[model samples]
Each structure stands twice: as C-alpha cells, then as structure tokens.
Target chain A: MTDITIDHVTKNFAIDGRSVTAIDDISLKFPSGSFSALIGPSGCGKSTLLRLVADILAPSAGKITIGGTPPDEARRRHEIGFVFQDASLLPWRSVMDNIALPLEIAGGPIGDGPRPETLIRLVGLSGFENAKPAQLSGGMQQRVSIARALVLRPKILLLDEPFGALDEITRQRMNMELLRIWQETGTTAILVTHTIGEAVFMADQVHVLAAHPGRLVTTIDVDLPRPRALAMLQTPAFNHLENAVRAALFGDELKAEPEPAHG
Target chain B: MVGPVVFVVVLLALWKLAVTAFAVPPYIMPPPEAAWTAFLKEADKIGYALFFTLRNAAAGLLVAFVLAIVLAAIFVSSRKVTHAVLPIVIGLRTAPVLAIAPILIMIFGRGIGTAIAVVVIVSFFPIMVNAMKGFSSTRKNALELMHVLGAGWFKTFIKVRLPFALPFIFAGLRSAATSAILSAMLAEWLSGAPGLGTLILDASSYRKTGLLWAAVIVSMIMAYTIYWLTTAVEKRLTAWRN
Candidate 1:
C-alpha cells in the first residue's frame, strides 16, 4: 500500500537571479515493501529526489504519489517519515522525547496499542532513552533519528544519507541494522547515498543518476537474498556487483583519461 | 583563583581597606562597617524601595518577553519585512537606554510606569533578536518531521519553535534582566522616582556616604539575585544541554 511513484519529476532552484536545475524529468516506481537506493555523485540530485518525495521540497513539474495520494497529503496523515543527512535530533530533547515527538505533536497517540518499544530495542538504545542527542556519539545519534522516524508506524520511510556522517565500522554496522529493520518492519524505504558499495549492499534496486540536471542513467536490480550478512561481502557475486557499480560510477571516466606521468 | 563568595569577600575587604587607608571622612567615604550599620538602620526604607524597584523590573521583563515573541513572530513570518526592519531594531538597541529614559519620562511622566518603560527599552531588543534567530533557523529535518507527524502550525510553533527559541531567548533575557534592574534604578535617578537610585541620590546630596554605599550594596545584591534566579531556570529547562 505504501508504494511510491515519481512520474516525470523535476526541481529547479533560482539562486541570486540564476536558475539552476537540480533534478530533471526523473521517473521511477518503487514496488511496495522494497528497499531502494538513489545513488549518484555529489550534486547528482539523489538527496533532492528524496526531499521531493518527503514533501520537504515540491517538484517543479510532474507528480509524486505515496500510497495513491499526494506526498504532502500522505506526509500530513503520518503515512510517511523522512530522515536527513544530519541526525536532526533536537538538541533540547531526550531520545524518548525525540522518538515520541510525532506522537507528542499529534496530541498524544489515540491508539489502543502500547508505545513503540520495538523501535527502541531495534536501535539498541534501550538504556539511553533519557539521554540527549548531544550526549550520544554520532552513530548513536543516527540510531535515535531512525527510531524517531519509525515511531509513528510510517509506511514509507525516506532516508537521505542517514549514515553518511558515521565512521566506516559504524556505517557497516548501521547498514546491517537497517537491513534487519527493513525485513522486520516491512516498510517501503528509500535511501539516497553517494557510496557505491553501500547501494549494492543495502538496496534491492539501485537507481544511478547523472549529475548537472540530474536524471536517471540506469537502474540495477540487486537480485540478492534478504537478511544479507556483512560476511556476504566476501562472496564473488558481491564483489562483482560492487565492482560493477563502482566502475559504472567512476572507473570508466578514469580509463577515458590518460594515466599520469611516472614518478 | 577565587570562588564566587571569596571574590565578594575580597571586594568587600578592598573597599574597607581603601576607606580606612585614606582616612576619608565618614561623610565623604564611609567605612564598610559604617555602611552596613546605616543599611541596617534604614533597612525598612531600603527594603520598600528595593521591593518597589524589583516589581517594576519584573513587570518590565514580562512585558518585554511577550512583546519580543509577538514581534519576532511578525519578523520571521515575512523575510522581506525582517530584512528591512531588523537594522532599525538593531539601531534602536544600540542607542543607550540612559539617554532615552528622560525622553520616556517626559512622555509617560515620573512613576513606576516610566521606570518600566526604561527597563523595557533596555531589555526588549536583544531578547527579540535572539527569538527571531532561533525561530527562523528551525532545522529543515525537524520541520519535515513535524510536518509528516501531522502537526498543525500551532502545534509545531508551540512544541518545536518555542522550545528551540527558549535557550536563545533565555540567553537574551538573562542579559536583559540585568539591564532591566540596573536601568530601572537609573530611570529612578533621572525621573526622581522612588527607588535605590533615588535613595543614593538623596544620601549623596546630604553627604551621607554611609547611606550612599549602603544603597549601592543593596542594588548590587538585587542584580545578583535576578542573575542567579534566571540561571537556575535556564539550567533546569535546558537539562538536555548536558
């Protein structure tokens, strides 16, 4: 029910009397309950695309639908949640406060069900409920942000570089954690990232975008099994996929240019 | 090198030493002992004036808080108006409150009203500017979170913007509160309103240096209490700042 459809979406920004196209005529459909990644270089509109779908930014043309309704309307009905590159945890709020923010603003939960304890335990931040975002490390903060996004039982979650700020070890762990959460929750999630390995490792479908008026260049189906372990990176198929995605992104450009002079 | 109480003790010691060393006349430079004695002797009169001035200062601060919030709401709601009027507000802030107090007194007349007016002008601008900064720069992620959470504008404004605005607003208020108390006394000085400033003025004119020093001490204590109270509230509310 939470399938997202973006049809001919475009975004343009006018800055200092100059018009700059951020995203141009990109159309795609994300099947229900699937993990997808929009991957590209910096300034390639991956983030912009997620923002458009989040209703944080409206597309200049075309239409976006989340669960058959406008993205903005869906957002307002608590049908979707969006996470940003920064943790975006309120510095003035505790982990519990941050997670409960959606409920708090909606004038408390009207549901007969108990509060979101599964999300709390999922992030492995059970003991840090009262702790503020500032007290936690960056990895811990990102975990809190993930918990916050999931608090309202959102059907579709959009993440924009949520782990881009973490160290490699933390990022890898978070990648695994995200897979676990996706499998458990069955939420249709979309991630925007610049890392090639990350896209192949986590996404069910990786949509590569070209920069400077960003448009979809290719869509690579991951075709990998669910609940993938970190050790899968040792597999030849994983290596082939990672290499292919990387080569598609950068290797060909380097090959086209001549080699540097020998030292 | 010194704790807060220790610093105060040091200051008191230095003041006593200066008066004693100079052998200054009791009428010209009363000793600290003499000042304390005078303070106790005129405790009733001093207490009334202190209470009155504090009441005005508190009222002035409250008014400033409400006004700053309303004005900041207006400013943030429109970027064009904010860009145009912000400079003017800053310009008014730069103008000294002491220089403006007499003109305010002439307009409002000499009373607690004039004193409150003086304090308001001294305290309002900074608090407002801070509120404006805090509200306008609400994190895009937070805003999106609120939006997706089905929060109405009122809910987002109250729960998010208000709480976010608090630290900066408190910072501005903490600064402004001190100015409010000081300038309340100063306004009394200019307008002949009945407070510690008037007491100091009266004591000085009568060459009662002991009373003058005593009133000044009372004034300092008042300022310290306001600072401590605001600081305590700030710490409690911003426990997340840890």
Candidate 2:
C-alpha cells in the first residue's frame, strides 16, 4: 500500500584500501502496488540496492523513503520484507514454525495476519507444514522462504535472486506463483535478478542496470496483459519486451569496450 | 549388533581356553568362568557402586551443561569477552585432570563432591568448544534476514541461532557423556570412595584378579550403555538432520 522513492542514492565500499563504487548515484520511484524488477549482470549491485532499500545496508549518499518513512522506520513498522537468494530456513524448525517466525518476532497474537496455514497453502506447501527445511527440495524450500517473508504482510517485498538456484522449469513456475501472490496480496515487489525474461514477464517496469559502477541504464515498462501465464512467454510482445531489456543491458557501449589484456 | 555380540562371546571363550591351556596362575590372570562367578557373587555390591557413580556423573554433566550454555551466550554476545576468556578455558582444558584430582580430593574430602568436580572438569571443555562453534555457525544472510524482519537479539536467538546449534551441541554432549563416567570413576578410585573404581582398586590390592576383571568388564558395559543412550536421544531430537 506504499510507494518507494530512491532519491539520488549511492553506495560505496572500502575494498583493499580503495574506495569502490558498488552503486552509483541513482534515482527512481516505484508507484504503490507496482511490481518492479531490477535486472543486471553480476557485480552490478542490484542486490546491494535492494539491501539498502531493506535497511540492511545504509546508502553512502542521498536517501530512500518507503511510503513516507525511511527504510529503517518502515522496517520497524513491519512494512518491509526481504527474501534472500538462499532459502535460509532454520533447519530444526518445521515449515509451519518457520513461517510463524516473523509474527513471533513482532510479539503479537499467533497467526493473526494471513495465518501460517493460509500462507502455506498459498505457497502450495499445505501438506508440508510439519516438514523440515532439509527435507524439502530447493524449489519447495524457496516456497517456504516466500511464505515466511509474506507472513508479516509487509507493504513492500524485496527479493534478491530468490529463485536463482532453481532449474529453469522450477524458476518459471515460481515466477508464476510469485505473480499470483503479488496480485493477491497487492504488495509492491522489487525483485533483483539476472534473467531478462523473468524481469519482462513479472515486472510492470524493469530497471536495467549497468555493471562495474552499478547504475541505472534504463527503465523498460512491460505492456503485457494482466494475469500473465506461461503461454505468454511465446507471444511476440513478450519476446519484444525481453529483447528490449536485453538491448538495454548489453547493447551500444558494450560493443565499443575493448577486451581486457591477458595475464 | 548380533554379530558383535557373537564376536564378544567367541573372544571370551577363547580367553577361557587360553588360560586353561597355559595353566596360568590366578594371580596373573583369572579364567572367564572364575570372572563370571566373581561377577555374580559381588553383583549386589558392584550394582550399588555403579549406581552411585552414575548419579555423581549425571550431576556433574548437568553442571557442565549449564556452564557451557552460559559461557557460549557470553562468547556470542561479545568478541572482547570471548577473546579474553577462550584462551584461558582452552588452557585449563589442557591441564591434566589427574594432577588436579588430588587437590580436589583434599578439599572435598573423599566424597561424591570430589568425584563430581572431576567429572565436571573433564567434560566441560568439549561442550564449551562445540557450543561456541555452533552459535557462531549462523549464516550471514540469515542474520540479515533477521535485521529486515526487525527481530531483536532474543527473538533471533530463539527463532534462529539456538536451533541451528542443536546438532553441534549434541555432538559435544556425546563426547562429554563418556568422559563424565570416566572422570567420575577416576576420582572415585583416587579418593577411595564407594564406586566401581573403588571396587577395582580394592580387588587389585587384595590380589583378587577375578573380581578386578569383573569390575573392569562392568565399567565397559556401563560406558557402552551411556554411549547408546546418548545416540538414541540424539537421533530422536534431531531426526530432521537425517
């Protein structure tokens, strides 16, 4: 129910006694209820940007305001949820307990919002409420991770390559599942991934980022229809959208840069 | 399991036959039959002594468990405390328990307290080291997830880190279980207390080879029982890790 404003945010890291820019000065606004994706290659700091927005890392310059508050404040309000590339579930807890963790942290009444059992069913893990994380497959574990993240009913969902470890089929299935959850919950999701198709298929706008100094190259708006399906991947408009994102990622200046010298 | 039992039976039979064939003196080594007779004859006394040792060992283990958990919490909360204390803990672990037992015996005065203290000293190190390792084994990203969820330290520990450490903690307990009994027996022997260790010491002093062998065998059986119980508990509690 809230928009995110990234106003001139930049992040720098001190690596080996040298200041390296992980994210260059960048600015963007995500409208309320929008599904956006940040697509870039490795080392592009898209994940870093998401982490900053999640308040896990602070920006070196400028500010990021979610809804009307800062990232940290929003986090305290239980308005921000983050999912990592790894499932990261505690191995000893059952699927139900893992999903119940955020609510427990908030020190509220049990299963008060979107109930653990309901979220489990939404993630297609209804039968696995008692299963441990280790017993689930990689894709299934990620579903549990998703359920856990959504348990708090945060206004914003931040995913950093959440399905990057899964195979193509599973990843696509998860993308569809995510889109369904987003539509159902109406939570603004900002996914950071390297895959262009996933970006085009799931996002209302794809924020293409360049490498090295990780800055925004362009933002592509996807004009695909509502309730996107696996079959839409074969449509001309979907291919066009994918190609446009790819061009933004690897076009023009990429062709002009010379190759590095061999060691 | 049956195979091992059969092997033990065969080995004991071979021992009996070897002693008979060699016409070995009873003082040097008793036959298996004589050892068995001695075991039955002194069963009541040995059983009472064994129960005493087990109780003291259990008390020592309980003390060590609580101490290790508290120390692990301190170590996780502050690196400065860990750095200041861990070296000393490790050094103390390396100091021989035998060397300290006499001092403890003098202070505690030939009682269960002395044996329990020795058991705690011998078993403390493994639990502390393993629990420290387990607590520190939390994933970096998992911690960040906690940050995003706005979970405080207590919530994070209860919901994430503590459960993550259960397997490693159980590993420490398994090793500690054996040392608990061993150290207790040693303390009992040295202090001339009422335990299987004292029984063995008395039999040896009186040149009762049969009773000595029986006492040693009983101690082995107790150790095996402790090992099996620990493994069973570990399996039941941590079946998810399987």
Candidate 3:
C-alpha cells in the first residue's frame, strides 16, 4: 500500500560543536494513496522531515517506514520520488533527457513504468522535449521536474514546496495540475508548504508544525470534495479549513491579537 | 577581428621604426624584415621544430587533463584524501619547474619523455584544482536527487557531476594551454631536443640573430593560437550556457 509512518522521529544538527534540535520527537502518518500537507513557518523542519522520509538524511531518533519497509530499502527499490523547489534539472540535458535521468540511474526502466515521452505529454510539456532547462521559464521548468518525478511512477511522492517559486496564478494552476497527477498516479503524496490556502486546498489532511525545536501542533482534516476546482477556492468550506490550519500554526499569536485590538 | 589586426600592424610598424632609428645591432635586435627573411629561408627547419614542440605539448596536456580529472574524482570522494594529498600538490606547485627540470631529464632521459614530463608538471595544477572545485560545487539538490534515485558514486560522477564541472574544467584547460607550449619549449632547451626552443638556443649561440627572432615570433603566435583554439572548443561544448 506504500503508506508512510513516522514513529517519534527527531532530527538534530551540530552547529558550532553544539547539537541543535531541528525536529523534536514528532509523529505522523500518511495513509496509502492519500495526499497530506505539512505547513509551518521557516525553521519548522518540514523540509528536514521530507529529507528524513526520503532517506537523504537520517533521523536522530525513532524510525520511519514506507509501507512495511525502511526508507532506505524503499529508496533503493526506486519507490520514492522527490521534487525539490528549485527543479534542479541538469543544465546541459534537454527536457526529455532530464526526465529520463532517474531511469538511467535505476539501470533502465523499472517494470512497466511510463516512458520519458509519455511523461512529457503527461505534464503537458509536449513540444518542448528538446529544449534545455535554461531555455524554459520557471513554471515550465517546474513542470519538467514534475514530469521527471513521475517518470518512474514511484509509490510515494514527496514534494518540498514545488510551487513555492512561481507566481500566485501560476502556483494555483500548478497545484491543480499536481492534484490531478497525484489522483491519476494514486501515490502516497506528502507536500510541504508555507501557504495555508495551498495546504488546505491540495491536501486531504493538513499537519501544522511549530518552530524552535520543531514539533507538530495539530492535524486538521479537510472535508472538501475531490476533483477540486479553482472555483472551490472561494467556497466557505475551503476558507474554514484554511482558518483551522492558520489557527494551528499561529494559535497563540492569533488569540492575543483580538485582545490588543479591543483594548 | 579588425581591432586585433590593426593592433598587430601598429606593433610591427613600431618595431620596424625603433630598430631603424636606434640602429640597433642585429644580435641585440634584428629588424622585422630580417626576421621575416630568416623565417622564409629556414621554413622547413622551423616547421619541423614547431611540429615536434607542438606534439610534446599536446601529449603532455592530454595526459595531464586525464590525470587531473581522475585525481579530482578521488579527492572529491574522500575528504581525508584531499586533506592529506592537497598540501603535497601545493608544495610541488610552489617548487619552481626550473629547479625540477634537471631531475626530470635525468630520470626520463633527454628525449620527448622529459619534455612531456615537464609540460605535465607545469600544467597539471590549475586543471586539478579547478576540477576539484567544480566537482564539489555541484548543487546540493542535484546530489540529493541522485541519492533519492539510489545512483552510485560512479554513475553520479559520469552523468551529473562531470557535466556540471565542464565550465570549470574548461577554465582550467584554457589557463593550462596558454602556458603548455612555454613549458614544452623550456624542457626542449634543457634536454637539447630538436624543438623550437633548441632552435632558438642554437640560432643565438651561432649569432644567427635573424633566426632567433623568427623562432621567438613563431612561438608567440603559436601560444596565442592555442589559447584561441581552446576557447573556441570551450564555446562549442558549453553552448547551452548561452
């Protein structure tokens, strides 16, 4: 099923010979084929959590499991696909080549996974297959990265602010495209984001985190129906979910603001 | 194009004028015409010497390039090795090539081997250092992507790291190439090889000032041409950067 479970995971960094806790004993679960979002301000260690799950960085304590296997095992089996904020495509490689990179790394196509050309069309980048990364705009480059992330058809998709660099209009469009792709692939997706609206709109469950020895504050489930549209952004239910996530994120400060204004 | 041509013409005219005005002796400074006449008379000899010198420099540079890349890969793979070996490399680089040429000739014998060794010793440092920087400077995200894909070090190096390091490698190559001919010529002088460096020394010892000046001019042109050619190849390879 490829569900992810983080059992009391923690991450620490050594700065100036002192151990600084980045993620403090946090636990969460992302069920199979479900989309979840982690939202927090900077220093919240949301990115670190993603890295830990991808086995790019190890947890200082506790354990992480994808389906029933450890992250490293899942990773070695080519079951984890990560999309970074910067796209990170090789400048020398064309779009088609960049998307095909993981396949090459895996020692050729793993099973009956989608081909690079199929992914190019899947991400709606049809004619630009031969174009180099530098020749594309930021949004187009991100699309290429998304296509690349999906090329292997990994069971779990980890996105670390993939649309954070784009303009708002483009961000919403990419978000919609991502949701459609996630639904089609049926991957266990976890998105780390800063925007409350994005977290509420794209995720089935939103996990709020607090900084300074980062810890989870709360998890809010969105009741919004799927095949979510741009028009759903103005719906009261979406606004309500967004507010719940905001409250979880800025609960103390938000409560204090009303008293100061009233006084 | 026009600017360089005009500059060269002006430079030649000034050289001709200075020699005529000062009435300098041919040994001290031959007129431009004297050097040109000497080049035409000994064209075959000068051509052969030039060909030999070019071959030695090219061979040495190719060896150095491959060696530098392999060494850089090893250094990048381990910080302990880099820390241990980099100082010795730096020490070698700081030690004067002139000081080492005699020992190299004794070891390698007075042949093209000595010339190639000298060229490698002279041109290796920049390429190796620049290559190390390039290999290390690969983007963190790219490396992470490789990690996520479970690509081993060799595949990562070939597919991602090597291409990323091309511009830096080329930078080092260009720097090495400009000096490559100079080092090869120097080696020829010490080893008594029949290259342009030996030609220059022989012409001067025989008081053939015209031939000496001609050899110097030809060598200067070769150095500039090598630099231009390296840059041209770099442009073609890194065309995606534009």
lDDT of each: 0.85, 0.89, 0.93
- Give the number of the best model, judged by DockQ: 3
- Which pairs clash (backbone N, Cα, C closer than 3 Å) in model 1? none
Q: Which residue runs does candidate 1 get wrong by more than 4 Å?
A: A110-114, A254-260, B83-110
Least accurate stretch of 10 residues (summed lDDT) in model 1 chain A? A105-114
DockQ of model 1, rounded to 2 decimals: 0.63
DockQ versus reference, model 2: 0.59
Model 2 lDDT per residue over B129-242, tens place: 788888899888888989898988887787777777878888998899887888888888778789888888899999999899998888888887888898998898778777
Error of 1 at A263 (Å): 6.3
- TM-score (chain B) for model 3? 0.96
**Top lDDT: which candidate number?**
3
Worst 10 residues of 2 chain B by lDDT: B158-167
State the lDDT at A114 in candidate 1: 27
Q: Model 2's CAPRI class?
A: medium
What TM-score number comes out for model 3? 0.97
TM-score of chain B of each: 0.90, 0.91, 0.96
- Candidate 2 chain A has its poorest 10 consecutive residues by lDDT at A104-113
lDDT of 3 by residue, B1-242 (tens): 99989999999999999999999888899999999999999999999999999999999999889989998999999999989998998897788877887898889999889988888888988999899999999999999999999888898899889988989999999999989999899998888988999999999999999999999999989999999999999898888888
Q: What is the C-alpha RMSD of each candidate to the true structure, in Å?
A: 2.9, 3.2, 1.6
* CA error at residue A218 for candidate 2, angstroms: 2.3
